[model samples]
Target: MTLPSYFLDNPYNVEGTEVVGNKLSPENELIEYFVQFRNDDLLDTLNTFEFNLEINENLILQKTLMENKDSFRNILRDAITMGTILLNFDRDDMVNINLQGKRLRNNIKINLEVPSNITLKELTASDYEGDVVTFEAKVSYWSKKRTITHMADYKCPDCGDIITRPFKSKIKDRCVEDKVFYEFFKPNISEDTRRITLREISDDFSEGKLPVSISADVYGKTVWEIELSDKVIVTGVFRSIPLRMENGKISQEFIPTIQVISVQNMKTDKMELPDMELMKKFQDLEAEGKLVEAVIDGFAYNIYKKRNEKKAILCSLIGSIWIGQVGKGNPPMIHILFVGDPDTFKSTIMKYVINVSDNCVLADSTTVSNAGIKAIAIKSDDGRWSIRAGLLPEYHGGVVFLDEFGDLKSDIYADLKAPMIDGWVSKHVAGEDFNGRAETGILASMNPTDGVYDDSKSILENLSVLKKPLITRFDLITKFSIDFNNAYDTQIGEHFDKCDFEGKPESFLKDEEIKLFINYVKTIT
Candidate 1:
């Protein structure tokens, strides 16, 4: 077959004899050709063009490589084999081919930025099978990265000829002998690898039901840059590997994993200015000095008294926006522990916060374990490392409410210290290290050791069962007491009566006003 006249144009002006020769392959002409597709300058920086690959838009690539899929397939294989050559990056660094396009149309279009890309829930097995894709997801499990040699020298026993083979290839005789014999020599190359499992996470800052897991293998700088439970947008090629069962039997099913090429951390927060009108209203409220009071009243109307405690919860609701650079700024997250006797309505307060805040993560203390704090890394029966995410990591950048906090094991309470201070948990398991960051505020309620507050004794005396270090971590430690003489305290009795019904009691602040207040508070620097 004769090649098209356009193939000989050589827009890149690269020196080569053949149209698809080793001296100058079409892979080398890809960037240059795309640049000229829009009449872009050859000398300009590559960043000038935006190449976002939306997983939903697969035809963009299929359309581009339609004529010569095999040739580019070989290019992609070579790119992975010698990753450093054409891209001018390390062998471990991934090379992404970003293809952006419109939805529901045969014709594709490229945009500088693709707004509102498809979520992980929208992706099917066929969408990602053998092509490069991009999507936003949360990190559920992070495996400890290990350095292994890729290229190794081996001497064939038959011919005594030194030959090179990748780490996967078994020693064999290609030099004339029917029987294979080889001697191991030193390795020549090393690679950094960390495999991470990503799940379709709800971006609403609430802990929702996670979909099935997708495997993503991050290399080089990305291995260190990505963290567990982080919301990230990643671009990579979908690769399928043979599935091995627990008994080491290779199954017919193939597991899909992404060879990550680029990754970007997506900002996640509960409160968002839905529109400019809401933003204007928030600005007006801020100017009037009613925004703060409105926010406090929004959630506190359900709870009876304890104005100070309500204010503390409000502060926790709108955590500090500033992250310290020079030194640790005031711990942005406010952890509140309510120690009270039975019938103090401590659990009621917790329930109120859970209902009011959209970003609240509620869990019973009975259900929490040491592994529930961050991530649990366990060696599977198959001798492979497996990780499970805990409540704290899953609810990062949100509120964590533990009702019946006193019932938690001693070790569990001890585990809260790291998350309280540093806002993250670091654990090393199965010969791998993992750091899970949960920048979350905590609200917990528990009964005192003696089941009642002793005013005659010191504050520490009443809470002797709990450790001092754990007690000190709480920003506000309030004791809820009932004035026993007044059995029909209108406030407390009315609260219980109101809560018994289906509907919530009417609040002075309207729901829209509260939402506006939340939107306003989130805008604070």
Candidate 2:
């Protein structure tokens, strides 16, 4: 196949006729220079272009290659396009190349300053006009694919001229000589699409703020690789789509949309401890039979004196942390419910767990629904079903603190019974089925109906909302009450008087140390 004139540094215009004294574009110049001066290098580059990486000091590609980065990039891009032409690879534009070609490539990545990964808060509306950027986010929801024009091939009957025009580009559409309508127009389109909603996530939950999400359109080769809840690092151009008015007029408002260029699945396949030195320390503690105590000291550093509750939470945390290790059949998922009186540290303990948890979700029972706690497929305005997985399935391997568990709706109890009893959530909505392993542990809490525990009432009677069958799902049931004990009251009084509540005590273990240990346990698991 003959290469297009524009594909080389030829002075041939759109008319396929040679033009004299026209200034060559950077790509044209680079291509001509490469083929003439560095034919071997150019050919080698074309062959191994897919494996190219960041212009680093390697034995083959020298440091001088990065000198004229823009020019070199132009050459590489030209070579890649030529390779595409040779291999009959599908590509839309420079922004959207065959991602399979960029598997381990570094040259294209150098175009954008990555780790330029800004949070949704920092990525302002005004920043849409900027260059390519990177965002590390979780794929929250993915919509169905739709076809779009990649390019159009047109030919003129009279002049016998043909020209290829990319979609949304100002390239030669009709024959340059005829300047007439095409004799034949064949629009090349692709249905390779993965439209996803990316939500801003932080382990701290950003102190309980509304999550900022952006709708991203993944195309080309990376579409099929992405899945729901997959943590991905995306590098793309931020293109704002004009919102249409109800009256069909284009509104002034624009939608936040990203035309994804590359999607690097950053999901951790295995938990790994960062500190090797700390592993030895943990081993020493374990050998001395003080590991559990150390973990408790670290985990309950902020608390005054709630040993039983702390140990219970710790046990559940350990179980949730290592739950992924279990193979075959169902895992022994640990669920805990802390029923307590009002004006106690129930919420405090939940908050502490939230702070410590890496993949934990804190749900106020008043605001939660079956949709929010589990996966449910809902039909959108377009009549297409889209799966919206709740916090439980979304944070599958993690734990969820269902605060104010007493206030949980009665219907939610029946819905959760199956998932709790058998570690799985099956939701079939309007012919849409979503069955996933619900391995998430629920660290839930409840307060008494009268704001004080009554000795006259049974556990189920105190919280009328909590049914017996649903309550049985929990392996541990701990009670938080102000018992009128002399020694307990003295300890509480002493803690209230002496504890500064300023900085963490020197004797207390740090959260990182505990996290490292847990991660270490996961490595072994």
Candidate 3:
């Protein structure tokens, strides 16, 4: 059965209250629960039902509904209907009916807020089957929002009576025309339903685990407002779809899906800025016109050579952000490509900036793909298409460090043109149009071919792998060479010796102070 929405439902089970035995049906049980617990929310604009596993442990414990999520959600829907009907019992038709022809209960959405669910550790331990669980994940993809009819406003063709039947009970495709995407898609989702793709955070992938990705058929205004890369807590009932065979027929194989109950963005994960004292300290630096110099000093202090390269990167760091995008004269963020020989400390240099900078993602060519850097179209077992954002949109307002940039795939190199030149990119993939705004800075590093930097060759010749058009997008190119001059080598040797001799090399700022200063500058800049 294809169910993408819990659309306009019939008012049911409002015979005062069901006075059955202790083993109350799920719908009656929820009504009793709402009356006793969530009564205030029932009358509120957003009809949210907050269910805490820790608090409402007893709600489904005796009834055994928690084990079967489909049945649980089905009953919850019915409960919402019965509760809405209960409100009409006291509502005066003349007074409650507003100019918009909407009752107070017209937009009463049943948002089920589950505070706890399966975790990464728990997922490895046992199979969840089809349990209704909650978990936090990053939104990777979204189908463009389309309007869908919640309830039929037109009359039945056979009988001129106003058709107020439950959307499901009505003959499929007779009144409500829903396009089939394996699962049905009504798509009139302006107020109600939307489809989004959620993937487990990158931490799971770093553990050499296949990060889980699932399609969520979400119902509500809240989840639809979430943008790409927004970390969200989603509550949904798991289900399996029959996998399609190569011959375009349904096979015995099954793939999992989630019918989302409700979703909320995980707001607490945002970076917490430092206290007033540190913030004010940077403000004072700006006031004294020494903020830029102070930020440069806070950068890599122990690295011996590449003084000019350091300044170039500092230009990228400050200039990339401070350079406004508002005015016509304003330029996009500065992009820098560092090509050098081995032991030139390119990795060390980029890592320092990556560590100091907020929202920095390191994508090495050895691992990432073209689609991984930009957006890609993903198709689920059911024939639905969604566009998943790549590294650029994930760290949209921030910078990305592309390591081992020379070894990057040729196709991926060609893909970098649109983004580096223009601040936006569009991919017309799988019959879906995906456009993303990436006001992001690029600071990429590469070791020259054969582990040696050739100063005699032109800038483009030294880096033969990257295309000319793509290379031109970079605002600055810094080349690092290993100078074997006796004086320079002795100085480098002395710096290394000092590191081994003393506990550590001297720095202009402490580790904690450096982080505070960088983040502080990022904000004001």
Candidate 4:
């Protein structure tokens, strides 16, 4: 067949191709020539096409796109034409095609219609430009059918306005009440799901407090309820639209509702008095010459009763004044002096008292000076200045157990005179001034001069060995005598032995009772 003039005029044809005599008509000849040429070209192209373009398949396309840009463009154009034709023609069928020797470097949009039988798991997108770009997409598929209904009712406590709306899940449900309009979207509910009503109480509107009760149910079975105060507000849904509150004038965003938890006020009862039996037992122990042991045993009980009775004080005297009372007319600072020979249980008792007391200070002559009790100023990391109780301040309402009292320098002893009597310590350390009253007792134990008590020596003479002012500071002074005479020694030893052998030994009262007593004294003081 002869080629048509139009075929030769086609731009895709060579730039200067002449037309021969037309064997067919103008229109029919153009169609026939184009078909023949296209058939021939396609046959020749298919025959020569190399399925294996490069030995390295991965490098073939990348190399072609970079080295021969025109070829890459031609391949891309052909791919797009092919894709459009396939999409428009076989719109319901799935077709796969691969573009060879081509590179993609821009965004591409695609619309997919999910099959009714297929469920969508996830959706994602990738950018060929390697730049951050956000793309939004959604999945559409047929889902199991169900019904959902939303019934909303709200009351304005202040305005006395009531609004109610009924919405059905199958179609559009709109309601207008109290001069306000609402559009509700019904959610798909499964067979196992049920509808619930929630009420939210908030303090956002009225200043008055509201009493709210909250309850929950599953499948018509009640689960729990809580009583909440008006200060709290609840606003989230379980699988449907949750209860919400609006200020009658404006339509606010929906908020989930919450249940309030109620609390009960607890009343503390007064402690009851000890029975007569307990008191009689303590009295019997005291009468049997076990006063110290009895006191230790009943110390906690006594202090508790005494405290409830509002007694004056509870004091514990160990190596030094290990405990005292705090009240009006009580001294702010109490200086306790321990002046005795080594291994006299003075230091042991002082350590015990210090451990049991809430606060205590153990200082010797070196740590303390004539200046006064050293009060260290401590500033917390949070920028708060805390007057940390030093040995004296720490033991302010407790005891300051002083060991080696006689060993203290004369000047230091003299400095303690005023604090011991007046209960005040004036400290001037690092140019910082601290003056406070410490209401504590001074229970001091002193050894007689020469390490033994001399009966012939007068009380004034014995105390003269110490500073005059220091000696006069003590309220009661007693000397512990170690009698060398066998009669007196045996009598005491046999008595203690009988007590240990016949009754509960004094040593048995060493655990919780003694600890409770020490703690009780410190706490009350």
Candidate 5:
């Protein structure tokens, strides 16, 4: 029999048994009583006390019930607790379930693994943060290809001569025309032939199966050795003859010769020379001072941290200009003027840089007056033209240390104008245009006009050595001063005592330190 008309005709009823009752229905009193009774039964079955209706639209509830009538109530309750379904039972026609923001948590985790073979290079804190920091590091690993010495032993079958030699081969000919004819009476033909010929082969031939040894040493360590059969054939053109005479009579003669032949199949193998082991030995030797290592240790502590303020400034400025010119491939000639107090290290650093560099000259400005740092015309006994390089020209690829730079005569100062900028100094001495380019870095030092530098006045104003064009050529200018407040007499006394105890000569401080500093600078470049 069909159920009651109310139950069957209810639009919210999805199936025969499962029915969703709407709160906004006109028969709310009856629906509420039925819902309350059903909730009580569900609480008893599940052993839970609280139960609340997550009210949803009537049509959506009806549709969900229709799709899964058997599990409709359980599904509805789970959806409400998980926040996956939005509900509104007040309006029947607008009811709809949106399944967009649904998520579930399970037993899952993510991990990333890096391979062992991949190595990081130049890794530092600055790399991660993109900043610059100062630090020192040693060269960890270095690889360089070096020439390997090889020797071979072979006998010439045709000459019946035993020849042991070091051999090297090169491609001497390529594909060529086979008996080609130039005249119309003959036909021309070509053949492909790639051949190699021995260019050099060493000489060492001794009879019998003697103990032949071959060894290769890399960085003073033997890495490879091989002993081969004595019957190997040698191929090459003979350039020399080895002969023996008994009692002025010819007994035997060994003639060396070469013949073109093809090597059927060639095989090659490589042996890694012992490097790590030899490096360890070098390290041990370095520790014992038998080998020198590039490490700055006690040197820094023993050497005083003396700074030549003027020289440092000059180097920095000139270094910048030099680097700029190197970039443009048009480096300029440098001229500097240093007017400062006496006893300063003006000439010290100048001489230091000159000795350490590739080519340089140190001279007083007064000595280079008439010639102007370039050759002048001079008649020879044979009356032929001859040109000689002046002091500046001789200093190519290096620096010229000028002492007493501003002490030169005024006329000689004008001669420096062109060379300082254009790198050419010209003079009409001896009826010739004695012109030469001064492709050198200039470091000139001089004393101040009043014998001491004055900090109150500008450096350019105090030093009269710098004039308009000459002053502009300088990249930097600095003044040196001695501090009066921190004058410690005890320090000087201690230095004197140390010098006496060490039995150091009078010129020890000046000459020794300068020599050491020059040697150190030489290694850097």
Candidate 6:
């Protein structure tokens, strides 16, 4: 019952040992082997039709099967249908072929890996219509994993008639005889299906734009394996289905979903590195001259003075480029605190830093909580508790701007101590540990207790409202004072009024050069 030598000798043969130039077998080699084995058994397997073929994930885990997954799937489909026809059995009587694709390891080798390189904001239906696309993003949310009935056989409750249907068919479950109909009960045998949702890793969106929600559906063997909060690179088909409406009106809106084929967790190393060209350009700027000054001027072009403070902010932006392992063995990440009087542009500078940096997070100190600062464990609708990363971990390896710093409660300040000093934050919930490795620089600002810098009191005395443990964590602490009584305020106000009367203010850097400066600062290590 073995395959003939002449059949295996052809260059286009599926199970051939040698492949000729430009000729690829349309059939999977391992699947062809399975077909031969089935034929040699001489057992009437198709006549039994008792769902005996168990071609589940374990068979696909074989090296030969994985290497030829696509061709193997087609071969498996053809073999099942052709076998049923030859045995004079109904194709519908055969068991479902389960090819669990996700059971393959996250780093499984695939021939084609498309790097879409397009942001979630830019994705459109027409751009990649009917094609498979690949992109990398953080997992924003995970829906409850549930087994869905794909196909089933049900028996009539009254007449004892049996009927087969796909899962959730709109057709009524009824048996009819002589124009009389009776309802059917639940299925005795059924198949399984699975689904999940994948979303973009974005928090900020353009004004008036809705968030993107992408769902992925898996069947049989591809079910299970993905976890919440994992950073993944996914290859999937981009398609859309009509949104379900309450009134049943045919609305033009459609929900976007990616039919995922393969996925892998993204490598965490070099997550902070910029593109090579951007790195070279940043290096060239450093090699030239005044790289630090150029970045400072670009931070807030409208403001004047505060070079020393700007330099400290610069360190917070770039942080330290450390090698080897972290923890106590590495230099601590830089943190800066601005203690200033009202109307001195503390909030203004913080906003500018957030805008200029690529991976920055801006949080108002008055509104944040201890759990919100670190990580929070949330329970899903299905009662599964998962840890959702908070603001600090979301912007790791970048800058965090905390404004209105004086309003933070002391207890909330206590929670931030470890992350600021040790470069990691942890949350423990239900015996499960979730850790956020945050190598982020902190840029926080506070107002004087009296709302104005008290000239009569010493510097430390004016800042005594803040806890000493938190204060000591800052690498640089400075006070920004403004001459409120001086006539310069009046002159500046008058100048601003005149400028508004016209159309524009006096500008130094061109818009193009300002953008270049922002990009340069963002590329810094």
Considering lDDT, which of the candidate structures 2 and 5 is the better prediction for this target?
2
What TM-score does prediction 5 earn? 0.35
Poorest stretch of ten by lDDT in candidate 1: 100-109
Order the numbered candidates by TM-score, best leading. 2, 3, 1, 6, 5, 4
Q: What TM-score goes with each of the models?
A: 0.66, 0.74, 0.71, 0.34, 0.35, 0.56
The regions of model 2 sitting more than 4 angstroms off are: 1-81, 84-113, 152-191, 203-208, 245-248, 272-274, 320-330, 376-386, 428-437, 485-487, 501-503
In terms of lDDT, model 5 sits at: 0.36
- RMSD in Å for all candidates: 8.7, 7.0, 7.1, 34.0, 35.6, 12.2
The Cα local distance difference test for each model comes to 0.59, 0.61, 0.61, 0.35, 0.36, 0.55
**lDDT for each residue of candidate 3 in 1-525, tens digit (9 for 90 to 100):** 111113223232334444446555566667677666655555442334333223244555325356445656546655554454454344334233221124322344444556756752344213765767788887878775555454433344543333333334244434443332122233222245667777776521212244667767765444446788887787776766576775887787766667776676677336557788877876787798876556555566667756677667765655444254442334556788888888888867876765565556666765456336678777755667767787776767667778888877776776677777666767776576667777677888888776687878877788777778898888888877788899998998787676567743333444466666645545666
Q: Model 4 Cα displacement at 67 (Å)? A: 51
* lDDT by residue for model 1 (1-525), tens: 121121222333323123445444544444334333423322222333223333234443344344443343333222222211223223233222111100101111122122234666665667757665678887877666766665567777667777656654566545556346666766644546777888875422223333556877776546666666777887666777776764688776776777765677776554555477766755676699965565566564666666677777767766775367512555678888898888877767666665455566666764565337766775532335867667776676667888778778877877788778777777765565656667788888888878888888776787887788888888889988767656558767777577677344443455555654655666764
Strongest candidate by TM-score: 2
lDDT of 2 by residue, 436-488 (tens): 66677788887877777887998877766667788788888777887778987
Candidate 6 has what TM-score?
A: 0.56
TM accuracy, model 2: 0.74
In candidate 6, what are the lDDT values of residues 190-302, reduced to their tens digit? 32334455567653321223245466654334344444445577666677766655486755776676666556666543334445765565577678775555656555655
**Clashes in each model (backbone N, CA, C under 3 Å)?**
0, 3, 5, 15, 10, 1
**Which 10 consecutive positions of candidate 4 have the poorest summed lDDT?**
133-142
What ranges in model 6 sit over 4 Å off? 1-136, 141-259, 263-291, 321-325, 329-332, 409-411, 458-461, 485-487, 490-525
**TM-score winner, 2 or 5:** 2
